[model samples]
Target: MTTGKEYVTAVFEKVKAQNSHEAEFLQAVEEVFDSLIPVFDKYPEYIEENILERLVEPERVLSFRVPWVDDRGQVQVNRGYRVQFSSAIGPYKGGLRFHPSVNQSIIKFLGFEQIFKNSLTGLPIGGGKGGSNFDPKGKSDNEVMRFTQSFMTELQKYIGPDIDVPAGDIGVGGREIGYLFGQYKRLNGYKNGVLTGKGLTYGGSLARTEATGYGAVYFAEQMLKARGEGFAGKTAVVSGSGNVAIYATEKLHALGAKVIAVSDSSGYVYDKEGINLETLKQLKEVERARIVKYTEHHPNAVFTPAGGDSIWTIKADLAFPCATQNELNAADAKALVANGVIAVTEGANMPSTLEAIEIFLEAGVSFGPAKAANAGGVAVSALEMAQNSQRTPWTFEEVDSKLYQIMKAIYTNSAAAAKEFGEEGNLVLGANIAGFLKVAQAMSAQGVV
Candidate 1:
C-alpha cells in the first residue's frame, strides 16, 4: 500500500520532470495531495489507477493566435489558450480570462482547480479555462470590440452549449462577456446557452456578479460557525478592487463585518472606519481610476500600491485573498495570524501558497479552500445554463435564494467529506477528497474516455 505522501511525492517528481517551469503548478498540486492522504487511504483504487498523476495534467490544451488590428490599423497578434482539464462529471465549463499573465501553465493550473471547484458545487459542469494575453484596461471600446470578435472567431468553433461553455473571469467581465457573446452569436447565430455571465436580457442569471464574493463569505460563515463565531463584528482585509474583491467587501459589510481595506493592482486603500462602498463603486466601475485616488476623497485612508503585501501588516479578524493565485504567501499568512486573524477564505483560485496554507492550518485558523469557497461563481454559471435550457428567467429573489442554498450545500458536503475521511476540521482535505471522488466516480462511469 502506497502511503499518501509517497504517492504525492512521486506525482510531484513526475510533474517536475515533465516541465521544470511548472513549479507553481507542482506546489499547488502538492498542497491538494497532502490534504488527500486520508482520502487515498480510504479509496485505495485511486492508487491503483494513479489518479493523482492524471489529475495534474489536463486532457486537452488549445493554443491559438488572436490577430487583430489596433486603432493604428496595425495588426498585432496575441496568444490565447484554453485547457479543457476534465469532463468527468459533465461538459466542459469554466471562465475565460483576459490578462497579460495568461499562459498554458496558468490556464492548466486554473482548469485543474476548476474541475474540483465545479464538482464541489454539485453542478453538472466539467472543468476548463480559456484566456488570452489581451489587456483590456486602456483599450477603447472599438479596439476591445474588434479584438473580442477576432478571439471568438476561433473560439466559437470549440465551444457550444452541450460541449464546452465559457463565462467571464478577471479582465473578462460583463463588458468583455458582452463582446465575446455578441461575436459568438454573429458566428453561430444566437445559441442561448453557449456562454454564461451574459447580459440578463440575453439569458444571464441574476446575482451572478455577487456569487463568488458572496459565496466566499457564506463558506467563511460556515467555517466561523464551526468555531462558535460568525461574521458579525469582525474586521476584514480584502485584496483586489475587481468584481470579486468589490463584491466580497460588499457581502462582508452586509454581514456586519467591517471591511477596512480593499485594493487594486494599482494600490490598496485603508479606511479604519470601513471603506465607503459608493466611493469604491465609482472608482472601480464608473471612473476606472486607480485605488490610490480613493484616498483623495477620504484623506484619513492610506493607499499602498503593493497590494497584498501592502496591507498584510494591518490587523483584521479575517482575510480574504481575492486577487490572484499565490498572492498571499507564508509571510502574509503569518502576519494575519499574528494579528489575530480567525479565518481566511480564498476568493481567487489557489490564492494562498502552500506555505501560507500550512501556516494557517498550523495556527488553527479556520481556512476555506478556493474549491469550496469560490465555487459560487461557477455555481451561478450553471444556474445561467439552467435558465437558458429552460428558455426562461428566474426572479432575482429566486436566483439569490438558490445561490445561497447551493453555497451552503457545498460547504456542508465538503465539511462532511473531510470528517468522513478522519480529517475532521481540515477543509483542504475535505474539498479535495470530496471533489476528487465525484470526478473519479464520473470517470469510472464513463469508462476511461
Candidate 2:
C-alpha cells in the first residue's frame, strides 16, 4: 500500500518530532534512513515489522550527574550519558568520549552510528556509547585521575566484561582508561575484560592505538584500488592530531602518500615536505600540547589558527577527516572537490555534513563512509576484549595483520552491497544497507524484545 520512500519519510518525521532538539542524532538518522529506501523497497517485511523505528530508538539511556573536585578544591559538575542502542548481535560495545563538546545528541549520534559500524566489522558486538561533558584538556594528571575515578565509581555499576564494554574516544585515552580501570578494579576487582584500550601492562591489545587510522587508510586504499589506482605518491591532508589523525598520517606515509598537513583544536599545520611523525607524536601524544606548537619543531611548516575555514582548504590528492562530527562542511567539501581530491575517507563519526557528502558524490570522488572507514578502532577494541576474555595478549604484527584483513573485508562488503543495490560505487548507501541488514536480521531473528 505504501512505497518504501513513504515509509522512510513517515518514520523519520516521527523521529524528528519526538527528538526535535537532537540535531546531530537526527542528521545521522536521516542519512542512514535515506540509504534504506532501496532495501525497504525490495523487502517490504522490514517496513511491516517497523524495524527502522526500533533501530532508531535506543534500548536504554542512562543520564546521571558527575561531580568531582578540581585542583583548586572547587567542585565541578558534569553531565554523563550512556545510550545502549542495540544488542541483537552481542554485548553492547562502544567507546566513552570525554570532551567539553560532548552532549546527549552527540552521544546518541555516535551510538547510532556505532550500531552499524560494529555490524560492518562482522563481529558479534552491538552498539552503545557513553561519555561525560568533562574536558580532559589542560588538566593535570592528578586532576584527570580524580575525575576518571569519580566518573567510573558510578559507571562501574552499569558496565562489565560481558555486559557493556566501553573503550576510549575523543578525550578518553590510555591515561583516562587507566584511571577508570583502577577505580573499576577497586570496586569490582581485576576485570580486565570490562574495558578495552588498557595499558599493555594490563590487558591492552597491541596495535590498538594505530588501528583506527591504519584501518581508514587501508579502506581508502581499497577505494582507490577499485578505481584502478593506489596511494603511491599521493598528497594527503588529514584533519585532527589525536590518535586517529596521527596514526592515519603514519599509515598514509607508509603507504607512500605524503601527508602534508595535520590539524588539532587550535587549527592545522601545513608542511610542504610532509609532516614529521616523531615531532607530531612528541607534541600530541607525549607532551599533550596544542597543534600550534607543531610549528615550533618544524618552522618550515605553516600553522593556521582555528575559526576561518576548517581543514578542507588544504589542497591534496586525498582528504581524511579524523576530527569531530560535522568538521567538514559544504564550503570545505567544495574546496576539496575544487582542489581535485581523489578520495575522501572518514576517520571520525559523521565528520562530513550531508551537503558535503552529496557534493563529494556528485563530484564523482570516491568516498569511504565513517562506519566502514573508521571501524578499525572498534574492531581492534573488540580484539582487545577477546584477548582479555582469553587472558592472552597478541603481538603487534599479529594485531596489525588482523586489522588489515578486517578493513579490507569491510571495504569489500560495503562495495558489494552498493553494487547489489544498483548504486554501484556509492559506499554510503552500501555501508548503511550492509550494516543495517546485518543488525536488522539479527533483531528480526530474536523477535520483538
Candidate 3:
C-alpha cells in the first residue's frame, strides 16, 4: 500500500514529466499537492478514481491567433489562450489577462489555481482562465478596440452566460471589457452576462473594481481578530499600483490602518505619514502613470526605484502582495517576519512563493492564502451574473455588504477546516483541503468523464 506522501509524490512526478517546461504550472501543482497528504490518507478513493490526474489537466485548451491593425495601419499578431480547467461544480468562471508575459504556462497555472479559489468562494462557479500576450500599454484607443474586437471574434465561439463567463484581470479592466463585451454583443446579439467587469452603464456590478482589494483587507482583519489583534493603529505595506493595491489601501485607511507604501513594476513610493489616496487614484487610474510619480505630488514621500518585491522589507504591521506571481520570495518573507509583521494577505493569484509561505508559517505569521484571501473579485463577478440574470443592478452598498459576508465566510470556513484537520492556524492546509473536498465530491458524484 502506498503511503499518502508517496502517492502525492507519484502524482506530482507524472505532472512534472508531462509539463516539464512549464515552471509556473508545475510550481502551482506542487504547492497544492504538498498539502493534500492528509486528505489522501483520509480518503484513498480519490486516488483510485484518478481525480488528481483529471484535475490537473484542463477540460479544453483553446489557442488561436489574434490579428489586428495598429493605428498606423500596420498589421500585428498576438497569441491568445483559454484553458477551461474544470466544470464539475458549475459553469467555468474566471478572468482574462492581457499582458506581454502571458503564455500557456501562466494561463494554465492561473486556471488551476482558479479551481480551488472558486471552490472556496462557496459560489456555483467552476474554474478556468484565458489571456493573450497583447500588451495594452502605450496603445491608442483605436488600436486596443481593434485588438479586443478581433480577440472576441474568436473567443465568442467557446463562451456563453450558462457555459463559460470571462471577467477581467491584470491588464483587462473596464475599458478592455467594454470593448470585448461590445464585440461579443455585436457577434452573438446581446448576451449581457457573457462577460463580467463591464462598465456601469452596461450590465456591470457595483463594487466589482474594489472587490479583490477590499476582500483581502477583510480577510486580513479576520485573521487579526482570530489572534486578538485589530487594524486600529497598525501600518501596512502594499505591493502593486493596480486595482487590487489601490482599493486595498483605501479599505485599510477606512479600517484605521495606515498604508505607508505602494508599488508598481518600476518602483515603489514610501510615505511615512501614509499614502494619499487621491494622488494615487489620479496617478494610476486617470493618468495610468508609473508609481514613482507619486513622490512628485507629495514632496515628503520617498520614491525608491527598487524591485517590485522590495516593499516586503519595509517595517510594517501588515503586508499585502498585490503584484504578480512569485513576486514575494523566501528572503522577502524573512524580512517581513523580522520586521514584526502581524499578518500577510494575498490580493493577487499565487503572489507568494512556496518557500516564502513556509517561512511565514514557521514564524507563526497569520498568513492568508491567495485562493481564500483574493476571492472577492470572482465572488462579485458571480453576483454580477445573478443581477444580469434577474435584469437588476445592485447598489454599491448592497454589493459591498454581500462581498464582506462572502469574504468572512471564506475565512470562517478555512479556519474551521484547519482546526478540523488538526492544523489549527495553518490556513494553507485549511484552504487547500476545504476547496479540494468540494471539487472531489462533485467529481465523484459525476463519475468519470
In the range 312-364, model 1's lDDT, one tens digit per residue, is 77899999989998888888888898999999999998989888988998999
Give lDDT per model, in order: 0.87, 0.93, 0.94
How far residue 224's Cα lies from its native spot in candidate 2, in Å, is 0.7
lDDT of 3 by residue, 1-449 (tens): 66778888998999999999999999999989988888888888988897888899999999999999998899999999999999989899999999999999999999999999999999999999999999999999999999999999999999999999999998999999999999999989988999999988989999999999999999999999999999999999999989999999999999999999999888888999999999999999999999888988899998888744488889999999999999999999999999999899999999999999999999999999999999999999999999999999999999999999999999999999889888999999999988999999999999998
Q: TM-scores, in order shown?
A: 0.97, 0.99, 0.99
TM match of model 3 to true structure: 0.99
At residue 431, give the lDDT of candidate 1.
89
Count: clashes, candidate 3: 0
Which candidate should be chosen as best, given lDDT against the real structure? 3
Candidate 2: lDDT over CA atoms?
0.93
Per-residue lDDT of candidate 2, residues 128-147 (tens digit)? 99999999888998999988
- Supply the TM-score for candidate 1: 0.97
